[model samples]
Target: MAPVVHGFDWPDRFVVGTIGDPGERTFYLQAKAGREVVSVALEKQQSAQLAAGIDHILDELRAQDGNPYHVPADMPEELRDDEPLDGPVLEQFRVGTMTLGWDPSTSQIVIEAMPITTIDDEDEDGLDEEPEPDELLVVRIPVGSARAFALRTREVVAAGRPLCPLCGSPMSPDRPHECRLPDDQP
Candidate 1:
């Protein structure tokens, strides 16, 4: 199936689809120009081989345009080889969410970026340049480990919850809770 386009403003594109069974799992991304879509689907044991292939393609794209994070001078001797580099290091610099989709026609996985907000703090020294209010600086990472990426993303989101663990009740963020769980304890 063709990807569903989620609505986004100018300079941003929406990518939506599924990695395996479309009904079982769906992913989405809001990407801007020049951002890399790292296919993390390959991180799954069942998808590892495909991930390697996707990584190879992404590496070629990065080599042609020059990856923002990897300066030729900074590359380690071992990573300078033809094989694609691993995914963990790349995850550190990502700016927003990433989703994975598989194209059955080509058997290739599509990785896309999601929109994110940015806050810029004024520099006390006044030497640092300040970004415009509407401007967003984003980094794109192409991940070969989709399962790992998804799990990590979920964990981060879940950590922010104001919810009762025992009863699965929604807790008020503004009010104190009496539950014994550390997250609920007040």
Candidate 2:
């Protein structure tokens, strides 16, 4: 199937938010222009990666002059219109491969998200047909807005359950975290 592309040249609002409680939360990366909104579901690692990439790029750009970034304007250069998690919630599908890059001509951060596929056995049905390509969600956001998005994304992704001191895995919500230690250890 052809990609269901949601391309936004300059979105009015874009953010990453989560629904549900701390232990059973669902994270969503949403971009909106007027009333049109495109939502994509992604793994927590994806969220962390995206944020880190944006931050790394920003740092690289600033390190050229070895000074903190500062822009002067009557109004803020970046769009501070952060959409709350509970505001205008929309349906989102799981994402598979996600790509992030910069467009020099437009000076926009490009993010592409492809749909995730489920693993299944087709031998039972005796059909050997290959699966169709998944659709993608493409978002082109300005550098300023991209920075804001990165900040918010880091917050949301880190808001999950705390990690275990010994194991490094997220602590179980219901039971005490059991460290994955060696068999010889007590």
Candidate 3:
């Protein structure tokens, strides 16, 4: 069957949120355009990387001579969205691959998330290949919204289990953490 692309050119909302506790949380990438809403499950690392990637791209754009895009180094206050995910967070798919890019024409950040695909044996070229996913999510937001999205994502990711000061490992609130300290230390 042909692939289904859920495209949101100028979404009203786009953010990353979690549904569970700190130690056992499920991260989701959500996009809403008018009444339509789509959510996709993803790893915490992917969420962090997405935010970092957006920030990196915006920073590079802001550094350009004349700064045509008017990219902001910080998240705009007016665009900040701290509310919880809208509607029931029903995940459409688990994202396996994510791509980010800047659309110069619209001055927007483009984010695409594709579902996980199983790879079969190596092909004639000795390269493991995988089939295309049936569903995908494509969202585009302006520079300010992009910054806000990144900011909110960072906050959501950091809201997880606190790190252990001694071992620098995550400490669960519900259970004790086994801190693996350096041999040189106590």
Candidate 4:
């Protein structure tokens, strides 16, 4: 049996994809309610670390009925029109020393976050301040989906997949020149 770090009703409005390989790691988070998607990429090791971090985040998200973090409405506008928001937030969630490992037996991603101290920036003088901390959340996602997402992201980043360089449309690798219109034919 796969160890379920945490489980919650999969948000009707949320879908996240992650693609990782030995050299690159990419995560894609999409919010159906908001019609937003965020993508982030890191080095191979960093990506693994991020996957680990998300284990905790998924746990937290599942424990709560709604998203706990506050994202400004205007913040969505700041993202590139083509970029998704979920990927970036997931990437940022891992701040301190964190790592992610995959369990082949169960097709699960395991994330671990180490204990570390961070300063609360609420004070005016920028001094370290402590506040009542909330319980940490853990998230669990199926390993198959995670692997597919990671691979898709890597393909996009490597330019190995056929896609419109100008408009970012997924295209055929063998037909790179097919995009030209009849009038624009050379």
* Per-residue accuracy of model 2 over 12-124 as CA lDDT, tens digit each: 77788888877788778888888788887777888899988877766665565644343111124345544575466766678787888877677677888877765467455
Off by over 4 Å in 2: 64-82, 86-88, 118-134, 180-186
Clashing residue pairs in candidate 3, if any?
none
Query: Where is model 3 poorest over a 10-residue stretch in terms of lDDT?
Result: 120-129
Question: For residues 152-172, what per-residue lDDT tens digits would candidate 1 score against the true structure?
Answer: 344333333356776565566
lDDT of 3 at 23: 88
Predicted structure with the largest lDDT when compared to the true one: 3
Model 3 spans > 4 angstroms off: 120-127
Candidate achieving higher TM-score, 2 or 3: 3
Candidate 4 on 1-186: residue-level lDDT in tens?
332122212222323344554223354433322343222223444444453454444454345555443212221322213333343354423323444554445435554333234665565664645332222223333433343334443434454344565555556534444455456555
Taking all chains together, the TM-score of candidate 1 against the true structure is 0.26
lDDT (0-100) at residue 6 of candidate 2?
80
Clashing residue pairs in all predictions, respectively, total 7, 0, 0, 18
lDDT of each: 0.34, 0.74, 0.92, 0.39
How close is every model to the real structure, measured as TM-score? 0.26, 0.76, 0.92, 0.30
Per-model RMSD to reference:
18.2, 5.0, 2.0, 16.8
Model 3: per-residue Cα lDDT over 91-126, one tens digit each? 899999999998999999999999998655554553
